[model samples]
Target: MDLNDLFMSCKKGDVNRVKQLVEQKEVELNVRDRWDSTPLYYACLCGHTNVVRYLLKSGARCEANTFDGERCVYGSLTPEIRNILVKDYV
Candidate 1:
């Protein structure tokens, strides 16, 4: 599968697709795109709560930073997503 496929799936909140890519195809959960955005970053940016949860549970890293050195949790994340990442940090 294309590496961008995971990011696209998370951006669209397609949890099943994300799962298939990660579980079946063995895609790296923390793979970053050209912009240095991970699937978790996309999931949070798009407000896909379920996708975010699944990514986290699947060992996605909350501590990942964008190319600009900004934390994914500090990006366009919803409060719920911020909470999830914050809780994981602590």
Candidate 2:
């Protein structure tokens, strides 16, 4: 898949597809899209805690801040989502 497709999948929180693509090495985990976003960033933005954990375990950077300067965690999370993530992934 192309970079945009990969980014779209990441934005959609397609954890299985993300893992498959990454494992196949067909997609670069750290590749930045037009908006300068990594797969992990999109996953976090969409509140995919499971995806976040998986990506983090796979070496996706947790501290990649957004264009507006919010850390990946803070940029993507609401209070409820953050709590869930803290409980599950942190």
Candidate 3:
């Protein structure tokens, strides 16, 4: 599927839809938008911890050297989310 559906699902914190999209449709969890933001990035920015967790668990990347990774770490809505990015994705 397209990043639109995957990004919307993550942004809305639709965990089930995210799961279905990633699992059944094989959506790219690390797909970036026009601004170089990923599903994991939006999930972190929007405080969608569950969605972030699922994205990571499903193999979303968190490269510290990338633009989206930097934003995901800095723009994270919660400390726990930052910790997840630091402890798991990085």
Candidate 4:
């Protein structure tokens, strides 16, 4: 699939599709959309814990920022996700 599909999968919390795309299909794990939102950003924003963990393990960058200049950690919708992103960097 394409980057849009990857983003959609993350938003939908489809961790399997995300794994397939990132692992087998070899899609860039950190690609951002027009909004400058990466898959990890969407997963965090949507509160997909599994997706967030999977993306983290898959080496998705936590430093990706939104168009508004908010980091993914700041944009995260849940404390768990925020912890994950922060833990990675710190």
Candidate 5:
């Protein structure tokens, strides 16, 4: 029901709020917005790596492809962001 709230949190890059809502309220992580983009996709499209990491930590599915046929990585990330993501893996 509060899909828009999820989307807006993604847009604003509010990682803490997003986490709280998703954890407490059980909001749908994969809900597509009017633009047909899930929160993970939008976070990637916006290049918000911290937000992306938070979402990923919360089990947001990155495989939810958006209009560009790219994972969140391909659309908004550069080598710099790649380093951040990779750091977490290491």
Candidate 6:
């Protein structure tokens, strides 16, 4: 239920843990941590494609103007992820 757990789960690429937290806790998906990064941000930064997809599919925001948002694109490990963000943004 804690946001930290969700963030860690995403960063660790624990898809099941992320799924359980996102489903059971129903916490605000876009809630920023002390680092001003969201669950999706960590997922993207760590190049966890599945985590990023799950977050995006669950309505996570990826605005182009935001630092984290832009960084998500720059930090993504694959073009598929970048395409996902671009397509979603557009």
The best candidate in terms of TM-score: 3
TM-score of 1: 0.84
lDDT of 2 by residue, 30-71 (tens): 778777777777777787777777776887654323342245
Query: Per-residue CA lDDT of candidate 1, range 2-85, in tens?
Result: 887787889999999999988895699888788877888888889999998898899887653544224667764689878877
Candidate closer to the true structure by lDDT (higher is better), 4 or 6: 6
Predicted structure with the largest lDDT when compared to the true one: 3
lDDT by residue (tens digit), candidate 4, 1-90: 478889999999999999888889568887878877788779988999999899878887655344422577777899987887767642
TM-score between model 3 and native: 0.89
After TM-score superposition, what is the CA distance of residue 17 in candidate 2 from its true location, in Å? 0.6
User: What local lDDT does model 6 show for residue 44?
Assistant: 84
Residues 46-70 of candidate 3 have per-residue lDDT tens digits of: 9999999988888888877777678
What are the per-residue Cα lDDT tens digits for candidate 6 across 47-68?
Answer: 8889998988888888878876
lDDT of each: 0.78, 0.69, 0.85, 0.79, 0.69, 0.84
Error of 2 at 85 (Å): 7.9
lDDT of 3: 0.85
Q: What lDDT score is found at residue 63 in candidate 2? A: 39
Query: lDDT by residue for model 5 over 12-77, one digit each (tens)?
Result: 888887888887966887677777778876777677778888877776664434443355556665
TM-score against truth, every candidate: 0.84, 0.73, 0.89, 0.83, 0.72, 0.85
TM-score of 6: 0.85
Q: Pick out the ten consecutive residues of candidate 1 with the lowest summed lDDT.
A: 63-72
List candidate 4 segments past 4 Å from native. Answer: 63-70
